[model samples]
Target: MSAESDYVTLISSDGYSFVVQRSSACISAAIRRMLDPSLGFAESKTNTCRFENINGLVLEKVCEYFYYNEKHKNSKDVPDMDVPAELCLELLMAADYLNV
Candidate 1:
C-alpha cells in the first residue's frame, strides 16, 4: 500500500468493499481527516465509506479516478481523459465531503 497508514475499508451501499490505502483514501480530504486526524486520530466505528447519494457505477468511477491520481502523482505529462457525467457527480460529492 502506498498510503502512510493502515488499509481503509470503504463499503458501498449494496455491501461492497473498496479497500484502499491511506494515501489513496487521502484523495478525499474529508475521509482523510475524519478517518485519520493529524492529532487525536482514533479508530472509527465505520468500516465503509457510505456513499448515500452515489450509485455503484459512479463510486467505481470515483475510485478509478483516485487510482489514476495515485498512480501518477509525479507525472504531469499525462493527457486528460474524457470524463463521464457520473464522474462529475462523484467529484462533486467528493468536494462536498471535503467541504472545499
Candidate 2:
C-alpha cells in the first residue's frame, strides 16, 4: 500500500472528514471491527467509516485521543490530555460510543 493508503477517512455526522492513520484508529476496538475486511462492511471496502450519531467535534476529539494513545502506548510516561470543561460530557459520550 502507498503512504496515503496507510490512513483512512472517518466522516462525522456533520460531514466532517478526518483522515487518520489506520494503525492509530485500531486503538479503538469498535473502529477496528468496523474497518476490518472480515466483517465485510462498506467501510472496509472504501476505507471510510461514517458515524451518523457522532458529531464532528466529538469525532475529532476521539481521533485526537487515538493518536495520543499511540504516542504513549509503549512509554512509561503519558502526558495529560486536557479536554475543555464544556466538552467533558460530550467527550465521555463519544468515548463510550468508540469503546475506547
Candidate 3:
C-alpha cells in the first residue's frame, strides 16, 4: 500500500477528525471491515470513516485505545489506559459497537 493508504481519517459526530494509522485502527474488527479494500466500502476508497453515534471525545479515546492495543499486542504487563469515569458507559457502548 502507498503511504497515503497507511493512514485513515476517522470523523466523529461532533465534527472532530483524527488521522490514525490504518494498522492501529484495525485493532477494532468493525473498523477493519469498514476499511477493507476487497469489501469495496466507500470508507475503504476514501480512507475515511464517520461515526454518527460517537462524539469527538469518545472517538478520540477510541483511537487512543486502538494504538494502545496495537502497542501491547505482543507484550505482557500492559499498562491500563486512563479513562474518565464519566466516559465509561459511552466507551463501553462504543467498544461493543466497534467489536474491539
Which residue window of length 10 is worst by lDDT in model 1? 38-47
Q: Rank the candidates by TM-score, best first.
A: 3, 2, 1
Q: Which stretches of candidate 1 lie over 4 Å from their true place?
A: 1-5, 37-47, 98-100
Model 2, residue 13: distance off in Å is 0.7
Listed in order, each prediction's TM-score against the native is: 0.67, 0.90, 0.93
User: Which candidate would rank higher by lDDT, 1 or 2?
Assistant: 2
Residues 36-75 of candidate 2: C-alpha lDDT, one tens digit per residue = 8888877887888899988898898888998999899899
Worst 10 residues of 3 by lDDT: 1-10
Candidate with maximal lDDT: 3
Candidate 3 accuracy as lDDT: 0.92
Model 1 residue 78 distance off true place after TM-score fit, in angstroms: 2.0
Q: What is the Cα-based TM-score of model 2?
A: 0.90
Angstrom error at residue 85, model 3: 0.4
Which residue pairs show backbone clashes in model 1? 3-23, 11-48, 11-49
